[model samples]
Every structure is written in structure tokens, then in C-alpha cells.
Target: MAAPPEKKTLRIGVLYEHTQMTDLAGVDILGNMSTKSVNLVATLEPRVSALLPLSTPMEFLYISSTLEPSWTTPDMFVKPTHTYANAPRDLDIIMLGGPDPAAAHEDSITFLKKASKQTKWILTTCTGGMWLARAGVLDGKKATTNRMFVAKHAGEWFPKTEWLDQRWVVADGEFEGAQIWTSGGAGCGESYVSNTR
Candidate 1:
């Protein structure tokens, strides 16, 4: 009998910005897609666990401005494993997540510009889209964000990107290489994950 094929691992870099707990939901679901689904089955049929690959489909590196730890929301706090200066350059997926409408700092914008070149997918939630715009990655792409917020303030922030007023999530570009996934609100991050490969 041959061993199960090694699972392909996706390296995910989730950006941590201030006051944006909802944005984290996007990466959280992707990171758990395999484990969460399989764990339940393994509980029902314990033998199945041994046959399945132990390797996770996704590996996450939380990237933030500091290693000192910070609050993402009123109730959520995260201690990032990697800082912008030290994060791996070759990332499979990069998520610009966090609270909406917050201005992207120079360091974050610089990192996004560099990472976008090598990253396959870029997922942004709520006002996180603003950061991508600042990085110039969404210059010609059709994207969406928190509808209400975008209507009021996004124009000045993301003038280059074609902002849309529609539903929860909108996607542009090919999934195999470079793609942008933008979700409206915090809860919509799940929709972004479900639609993506």
C-alpha cells in the first residue's frame, strides 16, 4: 500500500491592524478549512484519523507592526508571530485584514507592495481594501468593501480602484496566480473564503 499523498500547504500571512477583529475572520476560516472539517469526522470514526494526512492545508504567520502584542478590537487581542520586517518574502496568500478605514502606515504599505509580487491571493475585508489601494495593487481591479463605509469615505482613500456598491464579497483576477478577494463586512469574510479555492 502506498502512503497518502502529501497535502499541499498554503502559506498564509495575515496582517494585523488596529481595531479590526472582523477582518481576522477571513483568514481564520481558511486556516481551519481542513482541520475543522476533518476533526469532526475523526471523532465519529477514530480509525479515519490515522489514514488521513496529518499535514494541514494551511500554515499561518500573523504579521503585525510590533511583537509586543496589541488589541484588534475591544474584545480581541493578538500577539503576532512575525513582524513586517521579519516575515517570509515568499508567501502563497496574503490577507490585509483588520478594522476598516484605518490608514495604512508606511511600513504596511511598503510590505504590501513587496509581498503582492510573490503572493498568489490577496484577501481584504471591510476597510482593509484601502490599504491595497494605497499599495497600488488594486489600481485597475474591480473591488468592493463595507458598502456603507465606502460610500462615505473610500473615495478619497482608494481613488484608483473601481469600488463597487453591491453584496458581501467581490473577486477579481485568476485564482491560480494573482487574485483579490474583498468582503463587505466582518461576517462577509466567510463568503470570501467559501468562494475562493
Candidate 2:
């Protein structure tokens, strides 16, 4: 009998600080794409059984500038699994949700600059693209942000980037070999994730 192939784990680094909860909704969908969910679907349908082994297991590392909890709202927050300085270098994906652009920390911007080179994908929701812009990762890249922000400040603030008026933009240029994806305002993240899947 042949042995099963080893499962590949998809490491995702979720960066957050004063992020909007709605912007992070796509992470939940990503969490549901694990091997366990694939098995459940196979059991329920009895089809796609042969494709179950192709599903990659996913691991999410909630990252913050500090070890303390990161607040998404005045009442809600998410604890950090790792700080920017100590996060794993082998992240497959770097995900960011909308946070107050003015409140962005220098450390976070620095981390994004470094991580973008190593990660396969960089995903941003709403104003989260601002951090990438501040990091200079979005410079010369075709990207989009919250529609309101794109119309008002994205162009003026980040003139180097080609800001587009769209629900979301997926730029697959050689950004240190990373594909960048940016989604507009709240709830657009859900559409982005679903379409990407």
C-alpha cells in the first residue's frame, strides 16, 4: 500500500491594530478552507473525495507591533500570536484589514516592506492598502482601496501608486514576486475571498 502525501501547511500572518472587524471577515473564510473542512465536504457529498488530499491545511498567526491585544473596535480586540519583530519569516500570506491610516506605526510599515518580499500573497481590505502604500510596496502597482478614500486621499497621499476605482484590484506584477490584492470598503473582503477561492 502507498502512504499518503505529507500535508503542506499554509502559514498566514494577519497584521492588525485598530482594524475594522468587518474588514477581517475574509480571514474566517480562509480558516474554513482547512483539511478538516475538506473532509467534511467530502463526507457530505461523497464526490470530490479524490481531491481531498490536495487541500492544504492553514495556520493563522495574529501579528501585532506588540504582544498585547490589538483592538479592532472600542469593545473588541484580538490577542497577538506574535509580534512583528518575532513573527515567522516563512509566511505564505500577509493579510491586513482596515486600520486608521494615521495611526499606522513605523514598525508595521517596516515589517510589511520586508514581509512582502518573502510572502507569496499580500492581501488588504479597505484602507489597509494605505499601510502598503506607506511601506512603498504599492508604489507603481495597480491597486485600490476604500472607494471613498480612493476618491479623496489615495491619489493625493500616494501618488506613486496607480489607484483605481474598483471594488477590488489584483495586481500580479513582480512585486518581489508577491501578488497583491486590495479590496474596497467593508464586505468587499467577502467577495474578494469568494472569488479568489
Candidate 3:
């Protein structure tokens, strides 16, 4: 019998804007559900999206239209690389965020398509959806943004996708779209439930 051909290693890229939007909210957000305060840690339940690789390494890539200071300061999950690394080749998964909302929307997509050949999974948070929509990723994928856009264009941009009014995390597309995840906007240096049913 003939032996099977060897499989190729999958590559993933996570590209985020240089700016990190500090979406504002208050600690008592639950009190004034309609209030979007600007000095509080919005309680957001971060949903983890698992990958499908057998043993591929996760690569975290960053991009900024502006000068984003290196975040070497440690907090929890990881320590800073403290150096520069190559793109596509290094990342197996891509996560994105910024100090501002428009940054994510303005710079995440075209860059993504340029590297889509190697990207296995593309994920974002909060207003990150705007970025994906610009990239045409959400052109036809079931996705959700925050209360703001959902009211304006969730159904319009992701025309090919099913836009749900309530869901903590949403995944659309199969295989090709596999691992594409989006979550609600975080407020005031933190994430919020924004999960209104």
C-alpha cells in the first residue's frame, strides 16, 4: 500500500489596530443599563474561541496606524515579546483591539486579506466588528456589533450573515469561516455584558 502525503502546517494571523479604544462605561452600568458612562470597568464576559489545529502554535501579531507603546508590562496571560517579529509566518491565531474604535475599523481588513492566505482564525472584540466589516469578512457572515451599529447597519453590512440581536459570542461560516469570532464592546478599559436579550 502507498503511504499518505504529509499534511501542511496551518498559519494564523491576529492583526489589531495600534490604538486601543477605551469604550466608556461605569461600575454601576447595571444600574443605568442605558447609561454609557466613561469612568467605569464595564463587566464583559469574554468568550474564548478555540482553534482546530492539531498542534499549531498561536502567533499574536499587532499593527497600529499610530505609535502604540509596547505593552511589556505584565498582568496575566502573557509577558511582552519586547521585540519585533515577522508576520503571518509567526501567528497561528489573530486577536485584535485598540485604544480607539475607528482605528480597528479603518485598518484591520485590507491587511487581513493580504494575509488571509495564511490566516486560520480571525477574531476580534467590541468595535472590532467594524474593522471586519470593512475588510469584507462580515460581508456575508453572521455577526454582531454593539447596540449602536446593530441599530444602524448590522443587517446591512453582513448581508450574507445572520445578525442576531442577542448573543454573547457569534461564529459564522464553516471551515473557511471557521474560527471567526466577535464579541461586544468593552467599556472604560474593560469589557461589558452589552448582551441585551
Candidate 4:
């Protein structure tokens, strides 16, 4: 038999919340070429098949001036979360997930350091990207976010990172103090691509 193709391993660190939205529609579902789609909640994302752990690791993190503790004990009791829990320090990838934006607010900067400090990629969706800026990983780098929020405020809040307003996905890179990726628009999430190659 012929030899099989080699599989590439990519560790993506995603930070998500409970109320945050997602983009899931496509050319057929949108009925238009510009419909921005997003799932209400996710971690690994259904699109990311073949990856271990179905539910994205969701943490009870807050992005604010004062750091707060996590309340993750409830997820184990809830079935909606698939009884999933957070990952240890030695996972292949780490993606933050949740459904609430306001609730994501906190002052804990250590989480970002611990998550993205030594991972292949620190990926985030929606407001989760906001946390990256606060973490200082995107400092002196470029990034983008969903158009739902005002650009002016987004730029002001994440001044260290460049605010990209393009209408497509933008991937800066994947490394410590090197690459920073951002989606141009949630609409383009359907045809998402990377700049790795």
C-alpha cells in the first residue's frame, strides 16, 4: 500500500465565554455572500474535528481591573457543558470558551500567561480577544475582532495591538512575541485560512 500523508499537529489556545457569539453560516445558509455567522458558545469549535476533547475548555475568567476567582464547579453539574472541565498545563492546545461577555471581565492576568505562554497558538473568539490585549500578548502586534463592537473603543482598549478592520481573516503569526492572527470578519469564518504556510 502507498504511504499515508503526514499529519500536522497544531496546538491552538482559544479563550471563549458563555454569552459570546460565533460565526457558523456558509454560502448556502447565509443566502448571501456577506452574512456573518457565529456560534453562541464553543471551545474547540465543532468545525475543529479530529481533535480530542469535544467541548472547548471553558474557564471562569474575568477581565477587569481587579482579579477575581473562577467559579467552574457548576459546569461539572450541568449537562449542557458536556460535563467538560479545564485542561492541565501540558495539553496539546488551549482554547478559552464561554457565553457571557460582561461576566468574562476580571483582573486575572496570570491565566493568559499560563495559557499562551508556551502553547503553539493562543486563539480567541469574539470578546475573548479582548482578554489577549489585556494579557499583553498582542502588545506591539496586530489583531482583529467581530464588527459588532465599535472599532474606536476596540482600538482604544487594545492600544498595544493594532486594530484590523479588514473584511477577511487576518493571521499575524503563532509564537511568543512573534505572530498574532485575527479574523477580518465573522462572515469570512466560513472560509477561514491561516498564514502559517
Candidate 5:
């Protein structure tokens, strides 16, 4: 009998910040790609942590940005497994998200710009797209953010990229070394649901 080819393991990193829970959770959807071989690591800035609600008494636990932790709210809080400074440089995919466009802008740009150079794929949702734009990762790429927000403000921030309308998700071509996937608000998946019905 001939031997089968060995499967390649993918290292996936998801960026995290306070109040940016939705899109971070959305990153889990990527697990569908190959759960058995895909390793998902949530990355954060130095000295930063992700806080999430508790089941009893409404408490919160501060998880180390570089250690794997359990999640109290499966749908809301995703405990990080690494800090940006310590995350794997050979990540195959990187996901970016924040509660607002400006959150962690300056602190994350330097690291993001460097990581994007080696990452094979970049997936961003909502204002998370803004972080990639600010990092110049989206330059010369066609992408989209939350329509409500982009309709009024994205142009001022991403003048080099082409912003499109009338869609739930906009996929752009490879730039440098990464393929970019961006979507409207966190509710973008919902649009697919409506279309399917």
C-alpha cells in the first residue's frame, strides 16, 4: 500500500480587544475549515487581557493574553492564547477585530503590519477592517466594512483602497502574500441566511 500525504497544520490567530466580542467569536467559524488540523490562537497586545462575564454572581475573569484559558460565555468571550509580541510569526491566517475603529489603532498597527507580511490569509469584520486599513494591509485591495459606517466615513481613512457597496461580504485578491476577506457588520452572516431562505 502507498502512504498517504501528511496533512499540513495551520496556525490561525485572532486579534482581540474589549467590547469586540462578536467578530472574535466569528473567527471560530473558521474552524470549519479543518478543526482537527487548525490551531486557533487569540492574540492580544502586550500587558493586555480579555475580560468576560461569569455565570454565577456576574463576575469577570482576566485571562493572560499568552495562556490558554476557559471561556465563561461561549458566545461572547474568547480567551486568548497569546500576546501579539509572543504570537507565532508563521501564522497561516490572521483575524482582526475591535469594538471601534480606533481601539488599539496605534498599539496594534506596528505588530499587524509585520504579521500581515507573512500571514497567508486575513479575515476582518466590521470596524476590524479599519485596523487592517490603518496598518496598510488593505492598500490596493478592494474591501468593505459595516455599510452603515462605511457609507459615511471609511473613505477618509482608506483612500488608497477601493470600497465597494451592495454586499454582505467582499473578498479581495492577494496582496504581498495574503488573501483578504472582509464583511459588513457582525450581522453579515445573517444576510446570507436571509438570502438562502
Candidate 6:
């Protein structure tokens, strides 16, 4: 009898602080794909052969500068699973949601600069691309952010990056060995994730 395919765990770090929850729609889709409920359904229903869970397992790390809960809005928050200093160094993917550009801390930016070089993929939604630009990873790379932000501030803030006015943009070329995937406003993040899948 042949052996089953090995399942490798995909570690994804979600970097956020004061980020809009809607900006993380794509990550949520990925999470759904990795859920046990879907896997159970796929295994039990032979007739629904098309319904399959992700081939590899997935682990999500909610990262923040500190262990404290990070606010998504005034009343809602997500607790950090790991801090920048202690988070695993070898992550397969790093996901970023739109946060206030000026509110990003130097430590978080530094962590991103290091993570970008080691991670296989960097997915950003809305102003998250701006954070990558702040880390100097997006310089000389073609990326897209929220269209409103692109028109008003992205160009002036990150002149080195070629910002585009699109719903989503994929820069397949390696930026320190990581491919960047960026998307504009709400719901577009989900679109980007669908394309990747």
C-alpha cells in the first residue's frame, strides 16, 4: 500500500495593532480552509469530492509588540499569541492588515524587515502595504494599497515604490526572497487570497 502524503504545517503570523478587522478577510478565508469542520466534511462525504481541506496544516500567530490585547476598534480587540521579540523566526507567511500608518512602532517595523527576508510570502491588505514600504521592503517594487490612500498619500509617502491604482496587485519578484501580495479596500483581501489559492 502507498503511504499518505506528509502534511507540513504552514505557520502564518498575523501582525496587527489598531487594524480594521475587515482588512483581514483573506486571512479569515485561509483559516476557514484549515478548519477541522471542513476537514471532517471532506473526509466523510465522498460524493462531495470537490470539497477538500488544505493539503497542509496551518497555524496562525497573532503577533503584537507586546502580550497585551491589540485593539481592532474602540471596543474590540485580539490578544497576541506572540510578541515581536519572541515570535518564531522561521515563519512561512506573514499577514498584515491595514493599521494607521503613523501609529506603527519602530520595533514592529524592525521585526517586519527581518521577517520579510525569511518568510516565503507577505500578504498585505489596504494600508498594510504602506507598513512594508516603511520597512523598506517595498522599495522599487510594484504594489497596491487602498485606492483612496494611493491617490492621496501612498505616492508621496513611498516614492520609491511604484504604487498602482488597482483592486489587488501581486509582485511575484522576490523582495528579499519573499513575494508580496497586496490588495485594496474591504473585500479585496479575500479576492487576493482566492487568486493565490
Candidate with the greatest lDDT versus the true structure: 2
Off by over 4 Å in 2: 36-54, 173-177, 194-197
Badly placed stretches (over 4 Å) of model 5 are 32-77, 168-177, 189-197
lDDT per residue, candidate 3, 2-108, as tens digits? Answer: 76454443332334334233322211232233222211213342221111111222222344333344331122122233222324433444455433334343434
Model 2, residue pairs in steric clash: none
TM-scores of the candidates in the order shown: 0.83, 0.87, 0.50, 0.51, 0.67, 0.88
Clashes within 3 Å, all models in order? 1, 0, 14, 37, 0, 0
What order do you get sorting by lDDT, best first? 2, 6, 1, 5, 3, 4
Residue-wise C-alpha lDDT for candidate 6, range 1-197, written one tens digit per residue: 97767767789899868788888877778876764546766678755435543444789899999989888954688999999888885788888889887778778888987887778888899899898889888888899998898976999998999999988888863545557898888667777665554
Better of 1 and 3 by lDDT: 1
Model 4 lDDT per residue over 37-137, tens place: 22322233665333323223223222222222223324322112211134333333443332233445453345655655555544444444555667676
- lDDT score, candidate 4: 0.42
Top-TM-score candidate index: 6
Task: Evaluate model 6: give its lDDT.
Answer: 0.81
Candidate 3 accuracy as TM-score: 0.50
The alpha-carbon deviation from the true structure for residue 130 of candidate 2, after best TM-score superposition, in angstroms, is 1.1
In candidate 5, what residue range of length 10 has the lowest lDDT sum?
51-60
Per-residue lDDT over 23-112 for candidate 2, one digit per residue giving the tens place of the 0 to 100 score: 888888887777777878888888867667666788889999998988886569799999989898668888888887768877888788
Each prediction's whole-model lDDT (CA): 0.73, 0.82, 0.43, 0.42, 0.57, 0.81
lDDT of 5 by residue, 143-187 (tens): 787777676677787887677764445454345545667777766
Task: Supply the TM-score for candidate 6.
Answer: 0.88
The weakest ten consecutive residues by lDDT in model 6 span: 47-56
